[model samples]
Target: MGKKRLVSLLLAAVMLLMAACSVNMGEDEPKTTTDPGTKGTETKSGAQKVVFWHAMGGATTKVVDQLVDNFNKSQDKIQVEAVYQGTYDDLLSKLKASMGTSEGPTVVQMYEIGSRFMIDSKLITPMQNFIDQDKWDVGQLEPNISGYYTFDDKLYSMPFNTSNPILYYNKDLFKEAGLDPENPPKTFEELKTAADKISKTGKAVGANFAIYGWFMEQFFANQGAEYVNNGNGRDDLATESLVNSEAGVKVMTWWKDLIDSKAANNLGRKTDDSKKAFSAGQVAMILDSTAALKGLVDGTAGKFEVGTGFLPKPADAKEGGVIVGGASLWMMNNRPDEEQKAAWEFIKFLTSPEQQAFWHINTGYFPITTKAYEQDSVKENLKKFPQFQTAIDQLHNTKLNRATQGAVMGVFPEARQIVEGAIEEVLNNKKTPKAALDDAAKEITSKIQEYNRTVK
Candidate 1:
């Protein structure tokens, strides 16, 4: 072969390899090319562009993008661009850093646990302000779902990805344990009894729930117990945590007892691990968010029948309820009137029955509106995946109260970690439930005071 010809062949191969590597690298990066005129880093879009910053990725990202596309195509006055802003923590961090600057999104989807911080930021325009100004009828929204974001009797953010923690069981394991598959436990004591029976079968771990703080929050609400003082911090800023109260102790004690008896396996603090155990049929039952319904169904396909019920109560507690979980949509304030109005329009559209129904059917998150259940797609979802209905019924049955409304604290995320650490300590036999919870409460109170001082 001629020397010049050999060199030409090598150059061609090198160019081909570089092109292949570029294509692979693009897959790992976020799709910032959705709208070339404005990159995601810049908070403000063109006059008509409504920059929507979100934390959705993976398969869920497609659903979010589709929703954005539908909203964008439906109107000519406004262009909606959905940007993936990394994980929830990263999104909050970026949002906090970008506040007070023009480099912030007009609309943001924030998680429920970050509600307090969002409220404290003073960077968001309350949804109720726009609803009242426009005379919008918010009667369609599920009161329980919206109740979480309500402050001073006014709704702040529009609930988007609402959910509830529910008890999921494996019917196949129930049958093996000689328990009725149709009737799952309704209380912690009953769950322990049933778990003991299932454990005896040696077919699977009787129960498994992640050592997550959200579950503890639900348990506190179930006992009509507040997670913080001053009416769960609704009346005023919370200076302390009440998660170490007697009611919280009862819930933690029950959880520790289950682990001690070997009836329930401890999955640590990772919710995914617990989900994996349940999906693999290693755990007969699990307590997980309603959002896990679709994933659980797909993960356990052709394996075992999955049954869902409300999160079990404390057996003696009456007139108690579960708090709403999940994220909501907040519109950034100080934007132009047109941008604000467009943001409100997008929020209204997203929470509308039709759109919410579509979102619920696709994402497995509970729809924010009661009317969403009336939509054909949602109705079909209920029929095909009956487990989805459990959360709806639970929400409807929940008692409207301060505790169930959830606590609002600026250091909520930190408080959640403290609570989770307490739960882990009890589950690992490092401390008694009371001791662990009390310590957690003290640590959380200190953190809250620090956070409040800085924010103020």
Candidate 2:
């Protein structure tokens, strides 16, 4: 069969499967309750109640709950119930299982890696549909934040919590190594020289980063290289991995050299462990997500002066950028018109300047719109925690290209694992950078082909 015909057939199959599945929140009455403060009168008023499944928990959950409460109070015609559904992976699985059913949430918060799958699932109401229907002007949003979800000149989802990678350094450690704390490294070459100096003191590891595929992906993007073919999978479906290219070689070689010199610590693949090592001052520098700034700051408060900087680039890199790492809100299509409209209204409220600023202040996530930075609450938070501004500047300085736009593949998480496995092999001296990455690329290409064949 032709590719497009195959795709259409696969979509139809997915729709049928979705219709057969349903979601149950928990054992107790479906665990899908309306707003608590509604006093059991919201349904009596014939108000549209929308369910929103999200992955945020702990302190972030508190913010989400508060926002939902506010949204409930602001309007009597609609009420939104936010459900905490474990991690992003868990949320995606549940969403898929509940697709096209009444048990399905009206809206979902999907991570960046799941964008391609969600787009092809044929289960979502494109945010563009509502935007155009309401004649909404979304020009206030940051281009880079919205760019990832925009395909074929239309937005597929609403950009919500967003962040990028950055470098976090200990100022005291830099001074102890006889390096100027104010003058941080801008390139990997400079970072190596500084790391060597810091390591000589034996007080702390020079630097550390988790063995994460996303970090490695950022390096490829910073070198102005594509991670996959077909314009980073924007122009068409990606067919193969380009991570074995010269740019990938340069990045991996530098990483291996850093480990060999004992200036870098490989904390396996756990991001939390790397963050803890840095926050405890065991490592002088670390690479982490912008969303971790609040915890890092709070953990290191009164212990040391923390410094933040952009992710280091390669010396020869000319034009490069960092891609966003966060989740976005998507509305489901298999729902009543009232439910969809209510879900869209809830999404709009969540992305408003006031709410975005509140979320940014509480979670340390970069605000999705420019107007959020102008809010009084955000301004006050920036004054107290200036490190948050570095990530914003780093994102603004990024070049807008296919590389920075990031890769969109149906099996992105698996591709990330393949790359991480390659990095581990190179670190353990099992293979050269080229050999490890070449092997990984071959495996990833196979996965891509298999996924496309199944979906198409």
What are the TM-scores, per candidate, against the unseen true structure? 0.89, 0.91
Tens digit of per-residue lDDT, candidate 1, span 1-456: 553344333333323322332211101123332322322222224538788888766666878877877777676677877878866655765665664478889999887877776776566788999999999888888888888898998899998877788899999999999999999999998999999999988888899988778888888888888999989998998999998899999998888899999999987777778888999989998988887788888788899999998889887885778887778899888688789898888888897788888898888778888788788888788898988778888989998899899988876766776788888898888999999999999998987787666555
What lDDT tens digits, residue by residue, belong to model 2 across residues 1-456? Answer: 664455455444433433443321100011222332222223426778898887776567777888888888888889787788876655665665664457988888888877887787676889999999999888988888898888878899998778889999999999999999988888999999999999989999999978888888889888888999999989999999999999899989999999999999788877778888998889998888888888888899999998998899899996988998888898888888888998988888888999999888888888898999889999999999998888989899887889998888876777777788899999999999999999999998987787787775
Cα error, residue 219 of model 2, in Å, equals: 0.9
The TM-score of candidate 1 is: 0.89
lDDT of 1 at 158: 90
| Top TM-score prediction, candidate number | 2
The per-prediction tally of clashing pairs is 0, 0
